[model samples]
Target: MKTFARTMLAIVGGYVGTSAIIAALAGIAVAAGGMERSEAATLTSMLGFVIYLAVIIWSFADPALLRVALGLGAVSGLSYAVVLLLARAPV
Candidate 1:
């Protein structure tokens, strides 16, 4: 069903957006507060995933923006994954 697909897309978008925002914020907070690197990373990753899921569930009413949402979501997800991986290694 198209409606179902749209809903799923929207949810995914929301999740990705929320994940990126949460992760970035957490990273900033940890850096500013002088928290342990490992602790900060863990907290950030967890918070990102939780917030992402919550946002996706909450944004199920807007079907018109499904395609855009999906694209943005995928981009955000990929960006986060790449950035996180990069951060874990020496440049």
Candidate 2:
């Protein structure tokens, strides 16, 4: 059961967290780095794969399952909040 929970979190939660991180990064690149939207999206999308892989590896490497859950949840939630704020900012 613990293994199953970890696997699910590593796969599903990692994906979700990575997606939010990518979106937030892309938005930051566009707004702060002064990059074009398409360029930022492309760059961040590529990095997303690596980030997802790392997230999965970390999920498994971490000894504490509760810590993994909380960490991933915090990352996903905070990243999504950043994405929302960026979306609302004036162009």
Candidate 3:
């Protein structure tokens, strides 16, 4: 049960964290290239999926690494949130 919770938390954290990173990058790309939101969302979703897989693989292979990974993932998510907000700020 504990392992399951850890895995679930990791998966969710990784997905959101990675998606935020991708979203920020996509936002920059959209601003520079004048891309549509739909296109940027699709690209971000794909990147998030890839990150999910990588994190899941690592989590299953090494349970002991879950704590560190989760901590780092949380930090990444927070940083991404800050970047997203800053990127969306009005000039």
| Top candidate, metric TM-score | 2
lDDT of 3 by residue, 1-91 (tens): 8787767766876666666667776776567667787997788768777876776676667657657476657767775876667577773
Measured with C-alpha atoms, the lDDT of residue 2 in candidate 2 is 93
Model 2 has a clash total of 0
What is the lDDT of every predicted structure here? 0.65, 0.94, 0.70
lDDT for 36 (candidate 1): 75
TM-score of each: 0.52, 0.96, 0.60
lDDT of 2 by residue, 1-91 (tens): 9999999999999999999999999988988999999999999999999999999999999989899889989988998998999889998
* Model 2: lowest-lDDT 10 consecutive positions: 71-80
Rank by lDDT, descending?
A: 2, 3, 1
Q: Which stretches of candidate 3 lie over 4 Å from their true place?
A: 32-36
State the displacement of the C-alpha of residue 63, model 2, in Å, after optimal TM-score superposition.
1.3
Worst 10 residues of 1 by lDDT: 58-67
| lDDT digits (tens) for residues 1-91 of candidate 1 | 8767657665665665766766666555565577777887787777776766665554555445655565566767766875586468553
Q: Pick the candidate with the highest lDDT.
A: 2
